[model samples]
Target: MAAGAPRIFVSHLSGVAVFDPAGDQVGRVRDLVVMLRVAQRPPRLLGLVVELATRRRIFLPMTRVTAIQSGQVITTGVLNVRRFEQRPTERLVFGELLDRRVVLTETGEEVTVLDLSVHQLPARREWEIDRVFVRKGRKGSAFRRAKGEALTVEWTAVSGFSLEEQGQGAENLLATFEQLRPADLANVLHHLSPKRRAEVAAALDDDRLADVLEELPEDDQIEILGKLKEERAADVLEAMDPDDAADLLGELPTDEQERLLSLMQPGDAADMRRLMSYEDRTAGGLMTTEPIVLRPDATVADALARVRNPDLSPALAAQVYVCRPPDETPTGKYLGTVHFQRLLREPPPSLVSSIVDSDLQPLDPDADLPAIAGFFATYDMVAAPVVDEAGSLLGAVTVDDVLDHMLPEDWRETEFHLAEEEVATDGS
Candidate 1:
């Protein structure tokens, strides 16, 4: 159970029969279900689907198994009859496993795995359990625990399996999706093409896809939007940031944009239109409309109270933002930001001005790409504050937005070479 350990091939896994310690025969293994495709390490077996004599299928986790005997597999955990309960037709396959917490024994890392992918191998015309990706914990958490461990274990290393023995395991996975790492998820989305992006969007229910879409890049955003029907696209847009919604609509053809906008709720459409009018690089354009705002005179204690509120936006809750009273120009009178970590370390009754940044540089609304890039590199900031000529805070530009404009010249060339090699192998 190390990083990049080679697992025994599925060809070597045939005829592994299953039985109980009481010597009651259960079923034989049919095939493996690998969730990941391209992994840094070996795959994880989700479980074995035993073909029962009654024409029913029993899902058994490899961890429940005690030994792989020549003719029968011995198990320690009793197969619960309740687990065989059929879900209603409305539920998705593996719906209960998403966002669940799992003790990844191999890496000793704990995280909620947001989703599971199944991989089908073409060579053996067989399926194998694949990789498991970890979700990152919340921002500004004191512990900063990793969502998943880096090490990958073969399906065989699973020593045991059971829910809390109090509840079902499937239920646990669904509750932890929000704890997943947005960046890792962004990378997973990055590897997919427009076609596959469309397929994935189609397969996922709108609510689940909406959650995942917010973590993806603008390019991927455009691709997913393009593929979805007008109503479906509108639903996702409704859940996204106003700025994100605008950016996605702007990328579409003008007629289609109007059509999509028409399909959206009136309130959502209006907000998107407002954000769309500004240049994408501007603070007014990129800043989320949903930032947590407080009067300049609010005490740090009051701010802390607000931060702890679950209703506050995750971004602003992690890093508190202070602003002057809403005037004719909101951006011209904007104040500085303080990390939530900083607030926790200091006295609670401190005034907002004491923690506010006095000399923070504000971004120009119309600053070109190089200037924006220079600002990020200059400040070494994960997010840079944006402002107009009046010295008001408009919005913030994130490192991810900068990355959209900075692709390497040889990126496609490298991909082309890989594609050519694939073609050659197939021809041979």
Candidate 2:
């Protein structure tokens, strides 16, 4: 099915043809298998199995199902017959997740996903979908459980879901960490408690979790690191900005730090070691190692071409460093950075120097947190360049990271101020 394909309910499913993206008819729905337990809820379809003329059964797990169209169901990307053989059995969430607190998207607000309530339907008591509720207020004063509220999204409203979708329950209105933008991920992380933070991290894959870790504040990053398993901790730390990795390691006890670094890949560990060489407060310390350094002679065209590659990391900053090529004796050969938005505004054939901002103010590697914050305030820069004593471009520190350090309180104040400003601006 196309992304905007029409959806049909499982109760309405009947003999729908299933096709892979390549238009090969892989299977047809046999019957809607609902798993009603002796006491527990019936399992959502374990999945649909297509019976072929050759008497072979091909199974497509509900998770891989992309969409339900007018007459056809679509599976994502491609189909592998062996996939059915290796299909994961329905997850038995008996231990931890069932009745566990989860982020519930109800009433268009994220409230806690609490346990189900057995509410007798008005007309009959036998038939009932799980009733969801929200716990409101502090205990004693006005603490109350608000019931009969659930996010009843039409199946058609789901644009896409990530791997963690099944874990949150197919029927629950939840989104995967990968599906959220970085800013939204940051906001979600900021709002969650430490334990909840750990649970969310556990739910995400290494790469997506790594991306979220990269954007978080150092303190939250350290706290989140403490809660993760050693293997998971090492994976996220290895993928993070070297400066952040070093800061996180410095916050940990020496023994644990060494253990994590040892588990990391040699190259990542070495880069982290180099970053840790600088004091945490300085320019060298704050700079990210993944700057997109380009040659002075590099044209806007060349940089544009480079940016077109899909493989670029999602954590890339809005600024592209215009520098002497990496082959030069020293990287700080004193060029400048071009804001990515500005670069995109011009034709590819334009010269980089034409768009480069020469008056670029930079920070020394040894600067303290306050100093960096002041730099952010002074220049009103979203990202400030980091440089060595030789004025060579190192990496850059985004304003978000600096704000994370400066504002240690529960970020409510900042959020309030931003909301007020938005209201004022909109009125104007």
Candidate 3:
């Protein structure tokens, strides 16, 4: 739903047919998977448990859900057909939450939960269970049978559903730190014992773990990845940024790397393989294969919409590469660049090619680290396109990648140590 759509009660979504972009029915949503948070904070709506035609159930992440219309759910068409397994921190909304008894925090009145309401947060694609639909008077089956006072209240008004802030286990700890930045979360993980670290890593959803792994030290990344189930490891790798995922895969044993690659989606595996073929410090090595690419005929509005994607980093979103036909990288031709600023200044209907910044030179795939750094410094560019000799746009290198490669290998360790020292100083 768009920003204007009303908050929807979960009951309305029961057994909703889910469809791909092509209008083909993929499956029916059997249940919603939500992660409960500490205190009275609303739980995050993780995704849906979808049952396929053959009765196989798979987990569909909230990220892949594009829309929920009157009677059907729309997806991005990408799916992982693995069986849905509930994690320690996950609760099935249909199986675990409904027909449960809860208490109103203020009035101390017991109520039976009939359903919950979910709202998609406006800024990003994340959705959360924000409201509870409950009925008062007699509890249990009696309440279901008899008419009773029913009202929808903010999720915070009910106290029974939240996991306690002081509760034991990694799930509780994970809930407490749910709002942390990935870097801060990585620091927390760095300080946790090996077993606790593994527990927390396992509890995190694939996207979250991918973010944390990117910020972690190389050794820690390997350690955490090694502890994950092989299939889960592959899923997490696919969730990660292509460049970071490639770097992680490059560090693994050849046999293990192949094993994980075999589990990943073919397209993602191909990107990893291509990236691994490049020298570690070269432009090809550092660039992401998923840079936003648009055909010359695409409008500024189209570019703006692509840039607005929440998954992209600021560097990646800074500019969009305009190319020829075959918008996917390596695109047909390295046409030119259209910086975000330029897109903003132009009329929405303006063709991207009309205002392209053709003068700035693109980087060669084999451009060395120092050379890439110099290009960024000389152009004062946050990101620059990488083009091959055949004039196809290979990818785009961002300044962040350059900084990552230029930094000392032990930098994350140093940062973790410094954070620990500061915390100890505060305690002292």
Candidate 4:
């Protein structure tokens, strides 16, 4: 290590708050951008990906960074607010490099790159990767003790492996991405090339892939779905919220849609088909078929158990529908809903029907977008149940789905501008 080098491990810097010279927070460090040069040379630090309060990401060149220390990064108070777009030569440290496999040059041993150490070069304004902390092991033996601790080796002692050399496609890359939130992972996937995106998608499990797909743009969604085998694609669709699945399917060619739909489970397929039948802007189209539901005779305990499921969306988990037998959608008569707040207030053994909000009117399946939006605003509800003419419990439209529909058709392409400013000329 260089003397007084101000070295910091990349892992510790990942989410550190970024502040202006006056001490106001600008954003948090989401990722570090670097440019690779020679194979044996340390990659040059380019900038930081800062995610602002509005969830918009922008770039802050390292030149604008004044200090990096415990819990925070201090900036020179000058920043370009244009959304961060990765250039062809840039690599994201957290997304692309961390958790990857690298071979030790001396021992011919494979190890996982747990973290990286970056340091400021002596008497220079430049910072570069100085060392790598690697966990010794092959794929399955990752937990084995490495003489009681992992190795902190100089960067030159290891040869970094690319996704292609791993033989399992991009499976190793997926591990790094998995640590990111679904929205962040979606952002990374969106920036990757089509072939690389497909490879990463292939490595993700159905549930994780479904979450990422829900955050992606419709075109990206369609492209990724097309890359998946029909059966696996159907499985992923099945794993997604029904309304989201329907919306993605609606964007695809009819034949492709039907082919994947046929591969799904009969119940899920039926639900998706029913959702697809309605106008894209209507209540029926925006509703998810899998909202938490319970029989009228079920107890609060049952409802609570269903809400506890980690897979359920927050809106869906916030309440439970109380329906009469047969208890399945379309056949079950629409009754009422029990909010989580009310459910928690009542005794666990009490019947769900006792707390049901029967006075709340459900939206008709054909209700227009404006009508649905009005209902939410009027009731201050996170979700509203949709019913057919016979008052059958069909599904529930979540607030998020309605907002997505209300946004402009090209909303996904809009830059997350922080302020009106020209693009910076530096850091290409």
Candidate 5:
């Protein structure tokens, strides 16, 4: 490439808007396909995975790209609608390379692969990896310490780790997916063939698997669950939120569901049964039984500690249910709820009951979806407590779960596709 030629980082390439020669928007760049070569040689650019408005992904070979500029890629309009498939020799820049471990050729030190710069080769139209931007310490250590500096070195100075070379049964590939968000990991799993999806799922731990499974569509959820051993599947189900586990079990055959439920611990099995008894569109079906709860007399300090748990979803952690004794679900009596904001504003020594929102009415377990939706809209609450007729605290319905049921059946899949387009448009 000419010295003056502008180079683009692979990270920035992702979500760039692709336009036809006539300036009509085609799709957004999701990933770049590349072919690895001998040591010290840059990988060859193969094509672009363009996600269309219809949520269909297609391949756009490099030859079809007329020009590559900041925030946008110009293509020849002539495109192949066939779905992009990875060949034996190809690797995805965003999916496989970013945040991966690569060895520095000179010191043999392993650094986290941060980003890659690609440019057209000198005197030729072919684009190849030009430079690699990497961080020196263990993954995520840089962020925890400070905004550590990055080392920009020639691609040849670092050795790339390829999953294919490590073999099909390699567990190392799981490490790559660990860096991705559950939704993004679900997208990667959705694109893989059933066999590959199972392999990847098997490599993940129960918690991670449960998280990714929750993000997947019902069909994908059923398929992946079907792939696991009965015992392991039960464990993953147990690791999932009670409401989500119930939702998945509801999709399976009665016999299959029974077998899986039987394998789970009795307490978990009972929780699943209780959730399963409710209609799918009701508050009882959508609420998670694991909301943070405390006795009304508990200190604000206790409420803050519970909210500090990293595992709690933002919506679930936004408020704490103040119940009577027997604080576990079917908590003795639903007293009221204390918003997280109140906990922060009041002194730590203050009793939770003093700050509780007793005026906020709790929803009945049998409340319909419309009632649940209106409750959230009217109260402007991220979560609300669910109660039995006797006013015993059962669980809490989060806005996320409510929206999950309110949206269309294929909403997750549709939203994922639309999000990419929105990013593309916003970047443009």
Candidate 6:
């Protein structure tokens, strides 16, 4: 659901029909899986358990759900189809939460949970249980019941749903640091005990884990990856940036690398093979194959729309490469480049080729790290295109990749926590 979508009560979601993009009915909602937090913070709505026509129940991640309406849920048509197994930190809404007894924080009265309301975070895809509807009186027997007052309250107004058993489990730790950026989260993981690190890593969703893995040191990356089940490990790799994924694969034994590659999509595996073929320090290895490539005839409006993508890194979005027929990497003869600023200055309808900066020499696939750094420094460019002898654009290397190679191997050992603590001391 988007920012302005209505909050949904879990009672209304039960047994709702689920449809794919093609409007074909795939299944019916079975239950919702959510992760409870340490404190009163609302639990995150992870996904739904949907039972298919064959009565096989599978987990559908919230990321794939496009919309949730009165009687139906729409998906992206990419269901995993694997049996839904409850993770250690996960809970089922209908089976466990409804009719549960808990105390309201504002008042000393105990209440029975009748339902929970979930909503997507503004401008983000993550959904969380935000409200609790409860009955204020005692639970009635099968035939005889007591009439009770009912009301809805914020999730934080209730306390029993959070940590009541273990004081310091992976779930609590994850919730405590859930809002941290991937790099910061990776840093926290680096400092934890290996067992705790692996536990936390296992609990994170695939896309989030992939992002955190990219920011982690090589040793940490390998340790966490090895701890995961092979199939899930492969899925995480596919979610990662191609260049980063290739780097991780290169660190593994050839047989192990091949095993993981075999599990990936054919196109992704091919990209990995091509990337791993190059020397580690060369432009071909450092660059990402999924750069923004547009045909020369594309208008500035098209280029700007692509740049507006929230997923693109700042460096990758800095400019776009104009090429011939094929748009993927090793694209047809490279035409030129149009920086984001240039695109902005030109009319929306103007052809990108007209303002293309063809003067700058593109980097060769074999260009070494020193040479790549020199090109960035000389041109003051955040990113530069890499082209092969046949003039096909191979990929683009950004300044960050160059810096990663240039930095000392032990640079990750710098303790960010100490700096934060020092600032805290001074403030006191």
**What tens-digit string does per-residue lDDT give for candidate 1 at 1-428?**
11233434343344566678788777666544323212123233445556666656665544355555355667754452212323211122234444455555665645555443334343222234554444545322446644423333433332222223243232233222223444444444456666655655564434446656766655666777777767668866776666666777787889988898887777667767767878766555665555555667877888787676543345446665677866223433777776677788778778876888757766776776678788878876656666667766555666655664466534433544565678789999
Which prediction has the highest lDDT against the true structure?
A: 3
Candidate 2: 10-residue stretch with minimal lDDT:
154-163
Each candidate's TM vs. the true structure? 0.48, 0.50, 0.96, 0.60, 0.62, 0.83
Better of 1 and 5 by TM-score: 5
- Candidate 2 Cα outliers beyond 4 Å, as residue runs: 1-200, 214-229, 305-316, 327-332, 341-346, 351-355, 369-371, 409-428
Model 5 lDDT, residue 156, Cα = 77
Give the CA lDDT, 0 to 100, for residue 343 in model 1.
80
Local error of candidate 3 at residue 2 (angstroms): 2.6
By TM-score, who's the top model here? 3
In model 1, what is the error at residue 133, expressed in angstroms? 33
Residue 233 lDDT, candidate 4, scale 0-100: 89
lDDT of 4 by residue, 289-311 (tens): 87877888899999998887556
lDDT of each: 0.56, 0.57, 0.92, 0.81, 0.84, 0.89
lDDT of 1 at 48: 56
Model 6's TM-score against the true structure? 0.83
Off by over 4 Å in 3: 140-144
Residue 97, candidate 5: C-alpha displacement in angstroms: 25
lDDT of 6 at 82: 59
lDDT tens per residue, model 2, 142-260: 36544544443321222111133333432221243334655567657766777667666665534456667766665767777888778668877865666767877887888998899
**For model 1, how big is the CA root-mean-square deviation?**
18.3
Model 4: C-alpha RMSD to truth?
A: 16.8
Higher-lDDT candidate of 2 and 6: 6
